[model samples]
Target: MPTPDFVLALREHVGHDLLWMPGVTAFVLDADRQHMLAVRRADTGAWTPVTGIIDPGEEPASAAVREVAEEAGVDCAPLRLVDVRTHPPLTFPNGDHAQFLDLCFVCEHTGGEPYPADGENTEARWFPLEDPPPMNDRFLAQLQIVLADRPEARFRR
Candidate 1:
């Protein structure tokens, strides 16, 4: 489930060539907005908001909701798109290279308990907004944006 079938098909043809892909990150807050859900990635062991590649023809908001549920075992309703940015290209340990246009959404947890529901993550839990597990600069910045409670989405220009 980590790599989509479409992406796998493309990889079969292109091998390790760089792929430009659309991705989504969901910062899901509890109903009271005091806790944020995070997952420790299986690959990197870093705690981050729920993130996944957007499937072909999928709506971004729906993708965010789906990723939150799939990764964290929690259903969520995307409140708003919080940020859009193109991340720097990355090469996985397996040598597949890709760059992502990440669309970040601030979502409200609607149901279900959080756990690492998918094999992609090793742990999943809710953390206090004031004291979350350490994350990379990109995710940290996105968290700050969601915390600011902005009504409008940020677009990197």
Candidate 2:
């Protein structure tokens, strides 16, 4: 579902209030690690990694994998947690506000061609890792961290 049932239920009590949520960004790399999956968001038309809110009681890594499949029409396995950071708070056009604790994961593409499977995105495809399409500063920063392949996940201080 686009909006989770839990979030809808909570909205009944807190209309338009900022809701702190846990989210996932899945950087899905092909088996050979030469390319990464990206999706053009339907709302913003910006290219980004597969992103979604983690369901209540769901593991972040599992959410990453699930998001890749949901948004990009591909199966993947989380290779590692790459970053943990708080996203800037924003209000939706509908007046709902939310801030996210983002868990970014590097996932290995297990199978299937990439396409925008969900209405949330318009286009989904693989891009060369060395030269991905342009992204906003926030996403580019996370991309750089993933490319560095550090031993530990980056935690914003």
Candidate 3:
């Protein structure tokens, strides 16, 4: 993942310490709703739905779409807001600590083949709902919401 300029500026002061950041996750489903794109994140090498940190001043919905585009070279038509949650603080191997407030969305794939579009993700593929690649526990929860077709989104209080 390319560190954004905003984060770089903050790191100058914080220096890998905990930073409260905003993020977006897109559960990009196919038109039939039976498949979705998952990308192997470059940092973790773990397969997850396209996700990225939201830049300062960016809307969550737009960030979600942009993440999918950047990571997977895919266009998405957002279906609805699905869930919002603060991911538990994670400390990187290099000792950078951060926590994310994530806005999750369920989007339909509008165009483009699922391919590695940016260096953030090494691989991208469409997976069937019945047999998704392994994912982190947090992402698995988001996958549940996407698969359940939840009528309403989970909003942060």
What are the TM-scores, per candidate, against the unseen true structure?
Answer: 0.96, 0.96, 0.93
lDDT of each: 0.93, 0.91, 0.89
lDDT by residue (81-117, candidate 1, tens digit) is 9999998999988999999999999999999999999
Stretches of model 1 off by over 4 angstroms after superposition: none
- Looking at candidate 3, the ten consecutive residues that score lowest on lDDT are 148-157
Residue 10: error of model 3 in Å? 1.0
Candidate 2 segments whose C-alpha is farther than 4 A from its true place: none
Sort all candidates by lDDT, best to worst: 1, 2, 3
Candidate 2: lDDT over CA atoms?
0.91
Model 3 misplacement above 4 A: 155-157
Give a tens-digit lDDT track for model 2, residues 13-43: 9999999999998888888889989999998
Clashing pairs in model 1, backbone N/Cα/C closer than 3 A: none
Model 3, 1-157: lDDT tens digits are 7878998899999998899999888999999989979999888889999888999898889999998998899999878999989878999777889998888999999999999998888899999988988998888888998888879997758
